[model samples]
Target: GGGGSTTVTTSTDTDLWKDIEAGVTKLLSPAGKVVVDKQSSNVLVTDLPKFLDRIASFLESVEGSVQRQVLIEARILEVTLTGEYQFGLDWGAITQAAALKGASTLSAGKILAQKFAPASGGFQIGVASTDFTALLSVLNSQGELKVISSPKLATLNNQTAVIRAGTDEVFFETRVLETPSLTGTQTSKTVNPRTVTIGVVLGITPQIGADGTVVLHIHPTVTEKRGEAKSAIGDTFPIIDVREADMIVRAREGQVVVIGGLMQEKRINNDSKVPLLGDLPGIGRLFSSTSQEVRKTELVVLLSPTVMVGKKVDEITSRELERLNKTKGRSPW
Candidate 1:
C-alpha cells in the first residue's frame, strides 16, 4: 500500500529488485558453518546448491500470499517484517501490523478474521489495502505492538476427548465464586488433659527404732511422659500424661514407709516447675530427702493460618494466591 507509486516507476523499481536479489543472495550464502566429520565446513563449501534451492523455494512459496517487493517498501521506513500463518490465511503486512498492536498468539486466528473479513460480503483471501494503511498508521504512532494468543474453542474439543479417554479425571472439584480478600479469624481453644485414673504407691512400711523414731530412705526415680494428640478443643494438640512407676526404697525405719513414685514440686527460688522424687521412709536417709514433682500435661491449642487441616492441603484460596497466577482477565467469554 505504501509504495504503490514506486511500484510503477521503472527507475525506482530497479532499487527494489536489487534489494530482493541481495536478500536472496544472503539467504543462499552459508551464514554459518556446518560441522561434518568433526570438522567445521562453511555452508557455501558444504552445500551451495541446497542453500540456493531454499531461497528459490522461499520465493515460490510467497507467490500466493505476498508480493516480493513489499519487503523493500517496509525496509525504507525501518520496519521489520515477519512471516506468520493463521487458520491457513496470510495477511502479510496486516498480520505484522496486528502483531504491533499487542495481539497475542492465541488471538492470531480470530484477529485475522475480524480485520480481514469484508463487511456485507462472504470472505477474502488477502488483507485489504485500506486495512494495511490503517495498521501502518497505528504502527507509526505506537512505534511497537504486542502479539497475543487468544483462547480458542478447539481447546474445549481436546478437553472433551481427554475426558472420554478417562485421562482427564477431576482432581480438584472446589472453586471459589468470590474470593474473600480478607481472612477470617480461626476460632480454636486449648484442651485440658483427659482425667486418667492412676494408682501411686507412696512408700512401704518402715521398721521402728528402739526410741520409736523412724528412719528415712530414698532413691532416684525416673518418670516418662507419653504425649498423645486430642481434638477436644476444636483443634488437634499434643497432650502428655505423666506415668508414675514404683519407686526404689533403699531403707526404712519404725513403721515409716518407703514407696516408689515420682512427685511434682516447685523449684526453690525459681518459678520453673521441676520434678522431685517422692518421699520414702529409710530410703530418704540412704539417698537424700526429696519431694515429688509429678506432672500431667494438657494440650494448648494455637490458631495459625498455616495450620494443615488434611494430610495434603491446597492453599490457593489464601491471600498468598495473588502471587501464583499473576494473570488478569481470566473470566470465560
Candidate 2:
C-alpha cells in the first residue's frame, strides 16, 4: 500500500513539470514577441503628441517672455549761464550834497565842503548867492529836494568871475583874493561835491526735467556800502545795506522768464557832533545837526533753458570739455 502511494505522488509531480514547460514555450513564441512590440509602440505613439505639444508650449512661452523685454534711454539736457552779476550804490555821498545847500555859516559850509572834496567825473557842484536860511527851511519841510538848476561860470576878467544859475536865474560874482601867509601868499578856495555808488548781485541754478521743462532757482543780493563806522569795540566796519531773496521758477525749454521789481530801501540817521552839548536833553536838537538819508533800488533777473537730446548732447558735452581744457591749459579730471 506504501509503494502504491509513492508511485501516485511521482506521477502527479511529473505532470506538473510538463505543464510548466509548455507555458514557458508559449510565452517565448514569435507571436508573443509581436504582441509586446505592438504594446510598446502604442505607448510611444500615444505619448508623442502630448510631448510635442509640451515642447511647442514651452517654445511659445519663451518667445513671449523674450518679447516683453525692452530697452529704454533718457534724453539729456545741456545747461549754461551759471554765474553771478552784480550792481551797487552809495548813499552817504548823495546826501552830503543836499546838506551843503542848507549850511548856515562859512564854517559849516567849509566843514561840509571838506567832507565831500573827493567828487569825480560823474558829479559836479554849483555855488550861487542864495538865502541859506530859506534853503534849510525848504529842505527841512520837504524832507527831500532835487537840484532845479546847475551853475555855469563866466569870466568877467582875469581877477573876477560870474556864476550863473540856470532856470532859477541866480547869479554871483567872485573876485580872486591874495592873502599874505608866513611861508608865502597862496590862493585857495573850498569846493564841495557828492557822488553815489549802487550795486546788485544775482546767482542762478537751473535743472531740466525729462518732459523738456526747466526749473530755475535764483539767489539775489543787494548791497549798498554807505561808508565806514567805528564799532563800540573801536573796530571799524563797513556800513552795509544788504537785501536778499530766493525764488523758484518753472518754464518750457528754450523759454525766457523775467523776475523783476525786487526792491530795497535803507534809511540812516547821522549827526554832526557838539559832544556834551549835542547829548544834552531837548536842547541837543539845536547843537547837533540831525539828518536822515534814504536810498532805494530795484532789480530784475532773466533766465532761459534749452534741452538737448541724443547725438547733439554727446557732441556738445564733448566739445565743451575740450574747450574748457584748452582754456585751462591743463587736464581737469
Candidate 3:
C-alpha cells in the first residue's frame, strides 16, 4: 500500500515574513471601534474616556449659555396724605354775658385736637415693579381716617380721593346743613348752607433710562370752595380756591423723594352751653354761643424704589422660600 504524503511550502526570506507579521499585529491593536446592535437599538463603543470627554465639553457649553441670560427685579412705593385743619376763637363777650346770667360756659378748645394739631399725616405704599393698584390700595387703607364723616356731606362726597390712570384729574363735592335761624314772620327757618367741594388730582411720570437713572415728574392740583357771592340776577355763585404745582426730581433705587408743603384750610363752627339751657325752646340760641374755627393742614408724599439683579434676586427668592417653608411647618431645602 502506498503512504499518503503532505506537501509543505516554505519561504526563505525571514524579513518578508517579519513584515507580514507586523501588518497582522497592527490590525489587531486595541484601536477604538463602534458596534451597533440593530435588534436591541443600542450603541456600543470601546473608547470610553474620549466619549466621556466629548459629553463633558457639551455640558460646559450649555452651562455657559445659561449663565449669560439675566433677569431684572424691582420694587416701587407711592405715598400720599390728606389733611383737615380747623381753627377757632372763643366769643369772650358772649361767654361773659352767659356767665352773668347764671349759665356755665363750657370751652372745648379744639375739635380733632390730637389728629391735626401736632403733626401732619402721611401714607406709605409699596409694590413690585410699577404696580400702581397695589400702591393705591396701601394708600387707601392707611387714609381711611381722612374720609369725610358728616352724613349730609358724605352723601354727595366722592368715595375715593385717589387719582387713577387715564384721567388727568377728578373732583369731589359735598353739601352740609347749617344751623336754624329766625326768618320773616316765622319762629324758626331751616337754612341750607352752601355746597362745598374738595377736589384733588395727582399726576406722576417716571422715566427710567438704560443707565438705571430715574427722573420723576409730579403735578398736583387741589380745589376747594372758598366762599359765595350773589350774581347780578339774584343767583349765588361759589368762590373756588385752586392750588396747583409741578415738580421734578432725580432719584435712584432705594431712595426717597418727598413732595411736601401741600396745604388745605377748613372752617368749622360749634356751640356749647349748660346742657338743658342749650337745648331750650327759643332762648337756646342766646344761651349757646357759636364760635368759628379754621384749620390749616399740610400733606406730604414719599416715594421709593428698589432694584435687584442676579445674585440679589436669588438671595431674595431663597429667603422667601425659606419663609414659606417655615410657615408650612416644613424643613427648608
Candidate 4:
C-alpha cells in the first residue's frame, strides 16, 4: 500500500526575468554606463529587483522631448513530464492471463513451494516462490504493465489481499496536477515598423532551472559602409541613409530581453495492480504504457519604445496615437 503523497514548492522566475530586462535597458542608456565588451557583454546583478526598478524610473523620467514610446508582452510556452514504474502480482492464473497479453510473468508460488518442507515447519505456505518469479518475469518481459484510466487517482499502487472479505471488489487511485505557466517580454525602437519601425524581441527559453537566474548575453554591432564612397560628388545624397538605417536596426537584436517561469508536478507509482487484469484472445500483442497527462498556462511581457527621426516630437506622438487607435481599436494607455 504505497498510497502516500508528496508535493514540493518551487520559486517562480517571472519577476526575476522582468527585472533583469529593465536593468539591462537602463545600463544601455546615455546616463548609464555599461562597458561594451568585444563581441558580447553582460552584467550580473545580485540585487536584481532593485536594479530593474531604478532603470524603469530612469526611462520614465527621460526629457519629454525625446519622443520615446515603449511596449511590453508576456506569454507561456509549454509544460511537460515523464515517468515510469514496476509492478508485482501473485497466483499462476493472473500470470498466465498477463502472459497472453505479452506481459512479463513470474512463478512466486513455485519458488515458495520448493523452499517449504514439512520438516522445517515454522511458517505457513501463504504464496509459492515459483509463482512469484514467474509473475516477476512476466512483469519484466514487456506486457505486465497496466494503464490507470483515472487521471485524478490518489493512489499509484493498489494490491488485492488474498483474504477475501464480504466485498470482492477493489479500488485504485491516481494523482492530479495542473498545467505549467509561461511569461516574458519583447521590446522595439519604433512602434510601427512599416512606417517608422525598429525593434527587438527577448524570449525566455523554457525547460531550464528553478532558481530564476537567467543568463544575459548582450552583443552589439555597428554596420559598416560596403561600397567605396564616390570620389566624385553627385546630386544624390552621398549615401542611402534610410537603407543603411534599416540595416543597422535589423543588425542589432533589439536592446530588450524577456523572462518568466511556471509551475510543474509529476507522480509515479510502483507495486500496483488494477482490475481488467485478464487476457483476451487475439489481444496477445496488446500492450499499454502507464497513464500520464500534461497541461499548460501562458503569460508574456511586451516592451517597445517609439522614436521618430525627422518629425517633431508632438506631431509624431499624435499621429502614432491615432495609428494605434485605428490598428488596435483602443487607446494604448
Instruction: Identify the candidate with maximal TM-score.
Output: 3
Model 2 agreement with the true structure over 12-118: per-residue lDDT tens digits: 11232233223222222132221113223221112233333433343333333222211111111111111121122222332354346642221111112111112
lDDT of 3: 0.37
lDDT by residue (203-309, candidate 4, tens digit) is 21112111221112111111112222332322121221111100001101122221112122224333323344423455422432355443221111111111212
Kindly list the per-residue Cα lDDT of model 3 for residues 278-309, writing each as its tens digit: 88999887788888876554443444533222
Residue pairs in clash, model 2: 87-199, 87-200, 88-198, 88-199, 89-197, 89-198, 89-199, 90-197
Model 2 misplacement above 4 A: 1-198, 232-234, 264-297, 309-333
lDDT of 1 by residue, 44-132 (tens): 22335545445445434423212211100111121222233211123354345655554322121111111211112122211122222
What C-alpha lDDT do the candidate models reach, one value each? Answer: 0.24, 0.33, 0.37, 0.25
Give the total clashing residue pairs for model 1. 43
TM-score of 1: 0.13
- By lDDT, the candidates rank as 3, 2, 4, 1
